[model samples]
Target: MSLLGATALVAVALDQWVKWLCTEHLTEGRPVKVLGGLIYLSLLRNSGAAFSFGSAHTWIFPVVTLIVIGWIAWMATRLRSIPWAVSLGLVLGGAFGNLGDRLFRSPGPFQGHVVDMISLFEPYGQHFAVFNIADSCLTVGVALAVLLELTGRQRDGSKAVKKAT
Candidate 1:
C-alpha cells in the first residue's frame, strides 16, 4: 500500500483510540495533570469548528468537514511525491477521525460534536484551546506542508540547471 494510505489508517486509529481513552477517563472541565501544568487531559466537546467557533451553526460544521474530506481524498489520489502524500494522509486521517464522531457519536447523527481532551498551559491564563489527537495530527500535517512549500521542497522534479551554447 502507499505510504499515505498506511499513515492515514494509523492516524485515524490513533486519534480515535486517544479520544476514546480521554472520554472514558476525564471529566468535563476537570484537568488530569500529566505534566507540571504544561499539559493535561481534559474531556470536552466542541459543537463547532476550531477554538469552538461557530457554536451556533452546528449542522454546518459536518457539512463542511465532509466537503473538505472529499476534496482531500480526491487530491490524495493525485499526489506526486512523498511529502505531499504524507501531508495528505495526515489530513485524511484527522478528517476521518472527526468524521467518525460526527457520524456515530452520542447525542445524534450528523449533529454529533468532536471530543477534545488534550490541553496545554496553566489554568489561570493564556491556556490553549482544548484539542484532540486528530487536531494535533492535522496541525502537524499542515505545518509540514507549509514548511515544504516555503523551503521549495515541493519542486523536486525538474532537470538541473545547464549552460546554454
Candidate 2:
C-alpha cells in the first residue's frame, strides 16, 4: 500500500508539474520541435476523450472519471502483487490528473478542457493526438495490466491454477 500510494503521488506530481510548465511556456497551436520533428511540444485544450470524441458532451468525462477512480479504489482492497499495485497506481494517478483538469480547468467545472502538449511525428497532432504524461501513464499501466492478466498473474501475487482441458 505504501508503494502504491507513493507511486501514485509521484505520478500525479510529475504530470501536473509538466503540465504547468507547458501551459506557462508553450503557446497554444504553435509547435516547438524538441526532437527534430519526431516530437513536438504543442499546447492544445481538449474538451473530450481520445481524438476529441464526444466533445459536445463535456460533462460525461468527469462522471466517467469518477467511476473509474471508484473502481480503482475498490480493486485496491484486493491488491497483493507489487506489479499489480504499481500498474493500478499509475492508472489512478493518471485518472486523477485528467479529472483535475475536467473539474477545475478553464470553461467551467465538469466542463473544462484538458491541457495536452506533447505531439509525436508531426505538429498540431497531424500524426497523432496531442497527449500528456497522464495519458502516457494510463496507456502504459493499462497495457501492463493486460499483459499480467494474459499471463495468468493474480492480484494476490499468485499464479492462477489452470484446470485440465
Candidate 3:
C-alpha cells in the first residue's frame, strides 16, 4: 500500500480506538483531571463543527466531510513526497473518523455527534473546548500541509521554485 494509505489506516484505527476508550472511561460532560487540573478528559458529544460551532446544524458536517474525502482521494492520485503522503493520510483518516460517527453513531443518519474528550487550560479558566483524537490528527495534518506549502514543497516530489523577478 502507498504511504498515504498506510498512514491513513493507522490514524483511523488509533482515532477510533481512542474514541472508544473515551466513551467507555470518560463521563459525559464531567471532567476527569488527568494532570491536576491542567488537562482533563471530558466526554462531549459535538453535534456540529469544532468548538461546537453550528451545533444546531448537525447535518452539514457530514456533507462537508464527504467532499473533503473525495478531494483527498483525487489528490492522492499524484502523491509522491513522504511529507505529502503523511499529511494527506492524516487528513484522510481524521475525516473518516468523524465521518464514521456521522454515519453510524446515534441521533440519526448524517447527523450524529462527534466524540470529544481532551481539554487543555481548564485550570486557568480558559476552559478550552474539548477535542478528540480525530481533531488532533486533522489539526496536525493541516498544520503540516501549511508548512509544506510555505516551504515550497510539492506533492509530486518536485520543488515549487520561485520565479525570477
TM-score, structure 3 vs. true: 0.94
Give Cα distance to truth, residue 133, candidate 1, Å.
0.4
For this target, which candidate reaches the highest lDDT against the unseen true structure? 2
lDDT of 2 by residue, 1-165 (tens): 666677778888999999999999988867899878899998899999878999999999899989998998888888899999899889989988999999999999999999998989987787789899999888988999999999999998999989999
Write model 1 residue lDDT over 1-165, tens digit each, in one string. 287888889999999989878878777777787778788777878787777888777778678778988887777666667887788788778888888887788677787889988778854224677888888888888888787776666423233354599
Model 1 spans > 4 angstroms off: 123-126, 155-165
2 or 3: which has the higher lDDT?
2
Question: 1-165, model 3: which lDDT tens digit per residue?
Answer: 299988889989999999999888877757788767778777788897877899898888999999999999999997889999999899999999999988888898888989878889672225566787888889999999999999999999899989999
Error of 3 at 42 (Å): 0.3
lDDT of 3 at 37: 72
Q: Please estimate how well model 1 matches the true structure, expressed as its whole-model Cα lDDT.
A: 0.77
Model with the higher lDDT, candidate 1 or 3: 3
Predictions: Cα RMSD each? 3.4, 0.8, 1.8
| Candidate 2 global TM-score | 0.97
